[model samples]
Target chain A: MPVIGGLHRTLKGKAALFILLLSVIGLGTLAAMFLRTQREMLAEFEAERMQIVEHFVVGTLKPVMLTGHADLMSGIMASLHSAPGVQSLAIVRTNGIEAFTDDATMKKVNDRLGENRFSRILKEPVQIVPAGDPMLKRAVESGKSDFVRRDVAGDGTVTSLMYPIANEEPCHACHGDDHKVRGVLVATFGLSASEAGTLQSMFWFSGIAFVLLLLTAALTYLFIVRIMAGRVSNIVDQVNRIVEEDRFDKRIVIDADDEVGQLAISFNHFISSVEIYRIEEGREKERLEQTVFERTRELREKNDFIESDLKLARRIQQNLMPEKFPTPPEADFHAAYLPCLHIGGDYYDVFEMPNRHVGVFMADASGHGSSAALLVSIVKAIVSTAGKDISSPSYVVQIINNTLAKLTPDDSFVTLFYGVINLANGKMSYSLAGHPPPMVYNRDSGELQYLQTNGSLVGVFDFDRFEDSEYIFQHGDRLLVFTDGLVEAMGEDGKMFGRERLAELFKDARYERPDAMTRHLLDSLASYTGGAALADDVTLLVVDYKKG
Target chain B: MKITMRVAGDVTILDMIGNMKSPADLEDFSGAVNAELDQNHLKLLLNFKDVGFVNSSGLGRLVLAAKKIGDKSGHLKVVNLAPDLDELFTFTRLKEKIGVFKAEDEALRSFQ
Candidate 1:
């Protein structure tokens, strides 16, 4: 079976069922009560009719029987029997013998008595017993004055009444007064035709009333369902459309001030909120996207400007390095430079000093980028002007340091190694200002030594000092100077290509020419670092003393 | 690089770690030192035990710190220098300008 609760699933169905049920109970009860009243009214009318007939018959017979006029009594009974709806009228003795009867009652007694002697004296006093009707017998035995009963026959209903004549003063003269009941008057009235017709009409009226009531109930149910279900269905349809189309702007159009209208109002409020939220969210997203686009454009423009400027600065820094070294006839100089950034802090220059000597200079400013590049330019200006004024390498360094210490910011300084090669005497003098010691490799002996100098960092303290160290150049000896970037180059495992490794490489590459030696050192560094990006600027300068 | 400062007697010990080679690193160090000086914490001990490297800019910052402290009529010292940094101090002759100590207690006692 399908679910039983679906009977009133729709509003129309529920309304119809409710109206039908209420009407059925109300009309059925009304009909039942009306029918019962009709039945009782008919019964009461029949009883009243029988009682009137009995009184009429008894009133007429009592006077006749008191006057001892049996013939008058018989004529009166015949007239009463001919009255409308009267089936039988008779007077019978207490022993159930008929005393007086109408012609119809006499005929019935004769037919029942069949050749009996009692049937011959129909006109005179006669003893005719209505034995077939036990009600009459019971009335006689009970000695009651009036009794009534009813029986249904094929043709009609019969109401029977038994009225007893009591023994009075006049009756005692005729009958010697031995019993209380002298005789009984019996009257039978037919009620079937009238009652049947009335009941049939009542039934037709009830049926018509019931049909009209049901029709009224059905129409009322339809009207209510149309008003309620129609409005509700409209709201549902609008809501479904809004949901299916994702249209928060739509609203229900119920105009009443009832519950459904209030519901529509609430739904519209919700939809309005949702629409506002959607609009706000869309605007917010657009605003965020616009902001991001603007920010990205600004960043891109700034980056482009910075990149162009850095490239220009890099070119200038590159120009500061010497492209060609002087031919000193005794030594060949070569240098390799790599900057971690677009601009580097490492700078090197080889210029001719007085007395036919060449000044080999390498300096590494702190940090990188434009600031360091600027610092290196200042150093270059100071060194170029001061180097000519000061013949000693240590004095040139001191002058540069004192100038930078006053000019540069406290958080920036330079480490430098400056050396002068006296080409005529084959002697080298150098000063180290807080820079890594330059290494000298003897190609013939395959031994590497560091040119240690007692000096402080430049551009840090005004009173700081620097000292010069001297080394005699020998044939087949190579001098290598580099910034800390060379020794501090880190591998993938975080180990530095330390000074020890550089010394080993310098000793091993002693047979290489100055240019080839610098190239070999860079290659080894690249191999050691596994081609990772350099974290600092690497600058290497190799000077090979070809002859002493 | 992280720089943390703590007080020992009258000395402010600034413990520095990580490489101090970049301009940004030096700026932070200088700013911290200046903040300490502004707070009248003149007696300072720069502890470089965990510091791995100090570039030219970092050395310059140390020198500047010493000079700033001296201008304020106070003393600045250094302690717990890493091997490389200790070598750098000797090469730069920074010990002559600023007292160099091998331990924090020694530096703190010097401040006392």
Candidate 2:
């Protein structure tokens, strides 16, 4: 959401527009009243001008009847001039031409018009412009003053009064008949005189109205801006501060029934509830972590106990292997045994044959641990009782496989390189079951040949067949037997010493004592792989086929 | 150190009364419940109404009881909490797993 910046004002509904509409309505009503008042005042001013015309014509004619002198025209002009709002006057006698008059310009206008001025200005009264005695025509006919509204001298709009004369007792002497109109007198007044008074009144009214309107606006603004908006904005500012500072713990304290007061109360309540929840959450989290810590400690102690017990059990289990192997009476025997770590399932043993042809066995479990060690122990026990029957290494493996097939888990199996050396003949036959082949170095040809016959690891299938390969050895022949671990030693740089490296190491090697050579070869391998952990068990067996 | 224990029907109601301030007592309480659960899987109600405060270690025992019951497929509910402990439950989202109620009847009826 976009933030509102200037003021923290939140007007929820339609209040602002409502106030604006009210102000315009108030001003419009006031203006209507002022215009109506001005129109009525103008109407009254026009009526007063008509009354002045009636009085001027009636008074002048009454006096002219008594004196019959030209002084009546000057007297009427002077009295009308002294009347308020009056500006000019012109009067003429009963002749067809200019008669007695008081306006100084009348003499000039009389010379200009001659006889036509009186008849033209008073006869029918031009409907368009100012003329003499529209009242004169009325007085001649109905004997009363008449009124007409016009503009004087083609300038501004105004009202004109025409008073006509038709009677005289003294007119019997040389003045002509009393029924013939004597003269017409004209009065001119500026309409702006009345307009000025009205304008002055409007000015006073407008001044007072403006002051009151301004005062009302100022009062409304004060109450709304200072009193109302002020209090509300104060609350809003506090709320804004709370939000900015993340001070949800603080609360607005209010004790009133109004909306803002209620809002303050509700806000306080919400803050308190959330604060309490936060504190509780802190406690709960601490508790859960403590529980986990305690559990970790328990598991550690339990693992330590279980590990020590396994060590003790491994020592007892190792004691069960055959303590000594008998030398074959008519054949030379050589053997090597290696276990990878603390314990493993690699075992080699020589048992005295009932027929005096010894059994030599070398067996490696598929993978080693306590379970495989237990299996090897079982194999040892079964083979100890089958001493006479285990003359051939292949027959021993076959019996072990059948016994272990039921004891092992599905898919578990072992491999063995087992053989029997017959002292009566110069030939020896060996069986290989999924184990690396033994190498025979023929002293005659000075070449090492590997005897490899593929077969499945035992304990997987009882129907699996073992392959036996034979070789006849001459004098000074050397046979080398080893587990796969011999070539798999890791070098100082973490590279494995593979079969090629081992074969290369054995090249052109000659030693007077086969035992010394065996010791020398194993020692050299150890030196080459210093500080590199062995990946598998290192096993070696060397036998010299001496001439009998 | 407060220990409040209630047995209603086959369900055991154990209220961690007062401030569970003593770690030894709390551990013992969790241990005892676990041994009892080992013998007979008793439904549990761990109430916190009178518990004023639980430091980190003391609260740990409650979690122990919860996990013990959870592992054995038995029910453990916490109920009738004072405000502060109630705060702890809500904060940890413990309210989601353990049925939290205001009173004993409410706690037991939750099983139904």
Candidate 3:
């Protein structure tokens, strides 16, 4: 299996082996036929020799036999037997005996001659063969000549012929016309040494020639296979080098215009395409990198510009709030503002109105960032100018609302809680415009209340109105007003720091000064939010009524 | 927020879902209102059964939508407010400008 497997390892090797097998079969058959034909010709030549000798014996002995010269016939047969390559010669009588061995047939033949010319029968006339020999019997019965080949101990090989002598009119007188065959001439001749040697030479020559032919075919096939293998190996080596070096530009050499050469050309074409694609891919990658670099630089520059502008806006917005609140003897004020972004919409202010009245203002414009910041600025301007003289909180709020409603978009609005606390009487009048109610905690009664009032969002409806809600302020009554951001700050569980929590904080911090109370509220809010960033602007304004 | 529109008689019912907090929610609610107003379907009912919280920004959008409908001489009303949102509406006096109904049928009947 391994030998056969080796033979068919490659296309060339398999093809060569196939051709070698065909040649061996063809030459082997040819040599076999040649030897067979030579053997048959040698056999026919030996048979022809026997028939000629048989004809000579019959022609010479028949006339001599008719003259009844038995001695003379014996001499002739003996001389023919002694000729070259003749092993034995004999004439057999029809009675299954040698012709001269039987006295009756001899006597009958002598009487027919009418002279006793064959009186003395030749003793042992060249023993023809056994009487029961099938060749001799068949020749006698069929009246025809037959031959057989036999290997003899002394002479290597010989052909034995049994020729039947016909009972013609002349032979009838001696045999009495009873048998159709008068006798059989039995002859055996050794094969000619020269002729055998020639045939053996021919056999050797055919065998050697066939071997040479097969050898030539095999060598030719091997030579072709070696040549093809070398070329293929060369191509393989070149391809390996190209792959190892990562050189797509190199092409395999096409030496011949055969299948192997075609493979080389195809590989070259593949390499060419790879080279082109690699080049294009490299160029595309470079182009993409360049584009990304440029875009990144441009975006970085724009981001820097926006960051700077936001910082400046934040500072301006911070400046808009009151630096210090009015310290009227009736109340101690504290406030904290934290923007969710660089700028915020939440605003708060504390200023002396008139005659010991403190004006307190807090507003949260809808939305946040730049747009909401702009809205709160407008609110500050209107409230500052309008509330300076007019003490009616609702009337001042109405003026601001009408101005903003005409000036801002329909979706733009502010929620504000503005109040005037007259320190002399400890009375406060405030308008709550869409704002969360402020918590008022009283120290004396230990009661917490919300100054809840209803007012639509400013700047949404042109005809929208706001009215004042009155609250009586007492000493130790602390008021906490805040934007929705403080209460709506979401905890990790998505729950809000709601109004109830703020109310609790405000009540808990009742004994603390307004500043300490505001700090506690913010700290609680920070705790509620788990220190996460606020999602909206937060503003806390704590005002404690200190009048006694 | 996801808003699906249906009709009960002449009133177009906008079933509001999710918190109307983000600016995108503002756009969605206002867009639904504008779409109804564009079709001249004056009677609008906003179903708030599935609504969660409405932030200040969200409140502003609601007012804007109401104002738009009012400017077009069409009525935009809301129903099925959660308790908190109902109090919110009361506190903000949004109920003064936009109708608040306890039920879809009652709101739809108001369009008559």
Interface DockQ of each model? 0.45, 0.01, 0.57
Q: Candidates 1 and 2: which is better by TM-score?
A: 1
- Clashing pairs for predicted structure model 2, backbone only: A94-A182, A135-A162, A135-A164, A136-A163, A136-A164, A280-B87, A280-B88, A281-B91
For model 3, chain A alone compared with the true chain A gives a TM-score of 0.61
- Per-residue alpha-carbon lDDT of model 2 for B22-107, expressed as tens digits? 54666657665776697775688876766665533354455556656777888888787876566445533446556789878978
Candidates, ranked, lDDT: 3, 1, 2
Q: Is the docking of candidate 1 incorrect, acceptable, medium or high quality?
A: acceptable
The candidate, 1 or 2, that scores higher on lDDT is 1
Off by over 4 Å in 2: A1-252, A255-263, A279-283, A290-294, A305-313, A320-343, A350-358, A387-390, A423-426, A485-497, A508-536, B1-112
Chain A TM-score per model, please list them: 0.57, 0.54, 0.61
- Please give, for residues A340-437, the per-residue lDDT of candidate 3 as tens digits: 85455889999887687888999988876667778888888887788875368988888889988988887889899999888898888899998888
Error of 3 at B81 (Å): 3.3
Worst 10 residues of 3 chain B by lDDT: B63-72
Estimate, for each residue in A92-205, the C-alpha lDDT of model 2 and write its tens digit: 442223444234323444455453232222233222223343445454556555656664331234665545565465644434454666655555554554565566577557
Best prediction by lDDT: 3
Query: Of the candidates numbered 1 and 3, which has the greater DockQ value?
Result: 3
By DockQ, highest first, what's the ranking?
3, 1, 2
TM-score of each: 0.62, 0.47, 0.65
